[model samples]
Target: MDYIFLNHTADIYICVSGETKERLFANAVLSMYDIMVEGKRRIEDIRKLKVDCINEEDALVDMLNEFLYLFYTCGFVCVECRVKVDEKLDIEASGYYFDKDKDRLKMEIKAATYEYLRIKKDDKWRANIVFDV
Candidate 1:
């Protein structure tokens, strides 16, 4: 569920293993772009958003907002964050490049909320997310 900002050089893979499959946690990541955009809108440009951070719960949110702002201020909507959950169903992700071709960009998510969104002490943020895609 994470996007690697290596253009097409690398692909993003997200694997979730845990007892909790929640969508709210997932939407929190998705909200990144949406919040900055102030709504669901797309951008008509090509750009890359590279992000690096010490992923704590609050840090994660800040990092995510930064990534989303890249497009929000630039007026781009062709962006999505990649978050991969581990066996414990914890969330771990990286930044990705925004892909936009035409003026029209589309973002669809089904689950707007979830029951789980927390980071465990074990490693990798330890989070879970579920969304309607």
Candidate 2:
């Protein structure tokens, strides 16, 4: 995964690959958070959580924002996120949160959009998301 800052505006272009859509989305969030704050990983703890958006793209943004929000507003570190897309097409993630000892993740996640979306050469998921940073 990688990120690019466009020239015209401060928006960020995020690219990620995974075997499945869920994997790609999760990897994207992990990369995004890691970029925001180096080594902001949390210890493993089991918990269940759910987040539902209007559609696939909206759901992706919602999940990403949720993780960032957890870190920013509550200083809640993410241990792991298990996602499940429901029949009605809602995204759910099970994970745990923690306290942040340092403000390592300072960059703001203004917003995300599934503008640049595609599949890779070897059959992998891809997307160039627009961040309102």
Candidate 3:
């Protein structure tokens, strides 16, 4: 796993890292989904996402909230993604719709928050994200 769960009293906190920024964003998405559901998802559907943000941290949070919107409103559970980070963030995501019979709901994430959110680069890109539950 590219992400690890952290201690948070009120919401979900995670430290996600990758060799590159695109990989960092992708891992963040997967980590969010990992917190919410426990099941295997097939790549039966695809969704493209775009987010315009002032900076990388905003981009990350907005992109995550977009995925959360899709999950709550359309039942899309992204299992894999291809991300491009530039003037704008673009993502091509693939996954199946959430199936009650095949998937278990582990938790509900209302949104990704800016509080305690940070993205940094050392030997690798890393992000600390907080989800509002």
Candidate 4:
């Protein structure tokens, strides 16, 4: 599966999988955005964002946090993202302005937490991400 929702008592958890690590990271980002805003919205702007991290899990957290920062501060909602992850995380995302006052939000994701975070790459890449809501 590309991703699946997991039951969390007080927050949110998503399990993501892909044939490669890069695709897995991209899926994780998409899942986070899905929890924030509807996926059907039109994308009007494209932004290039990058992050450097100590490890795979750190890169995932930084990428999601960056999106949250942009949404909370700039009203951008990502529709599509192309992500490349190594020692550095680079993403090119197509996003549209989403006014929280006017748009429908699924939930308020406060942060992407390290608690219960896992990044595993075997035959394929898989990860579990927890978000504080």
- For model 4 the local lDDT of residue 2 reads 75
Model 3 TM-score, all chains together:
0.96
Overall lDDT per candidate, in order of appearance? 0.37, 0.58, 0.90, 0.85
RMSD in order of candidates: 12.3, 3.7, 0.9, 1.7
Candidate 4: tens digits of C-alpha lDDT, residues 1-133: 2788889898888888888888888888778888887645777899999899678888899899999999889888887888887678889989789975668888889999998899998888999888999
Q: Candidate 3 lDDT, tens digit per residue, 1-133?
A: 7998899898888899999999999999988888899986668898998999569998998999999999998889989988999988989999989988888989999999998898999999999998989
Best by TM-score: 3
Looking at model 1, report the run of 10 residues with the lowest lDDT sum: 3-12
- Minimum summed lDDT over a 10-residue window in model 2 is located at 87-96
lDDT of 1 at 50: 37
Task: Look at candidate 2 and give me any clashing residue pairs.
Answer: 116-128
TM, every model: 0.32, 0.69, 0.96, 0.91
**lDDT (tens digit, per residue) of candidate 2 on 1-133:** 3334444355677666667777766666666765565454445454345677457666777777776666667555554444665532233343335445544545666666555644343567665566666
* Local lDDT at 115 for model 4: 86
- Using lDDT as the measure, the top candidate is 3
Q: Rank the candidates by lDDT, best first.
A: 3, 4, 2, 1
Q: Can you tell me which runs of candidate 1 are displaced by over 4 Å?
A: 1-27, 34-47, 83-133
Which candidate model has the greater lDDT, 1 or 4?
4
Question: In angstroms, how far off is 83's CA in candidate 4?
Answer: 1.0
Of 1 and 2, the candidate ahead on lDDT is 2
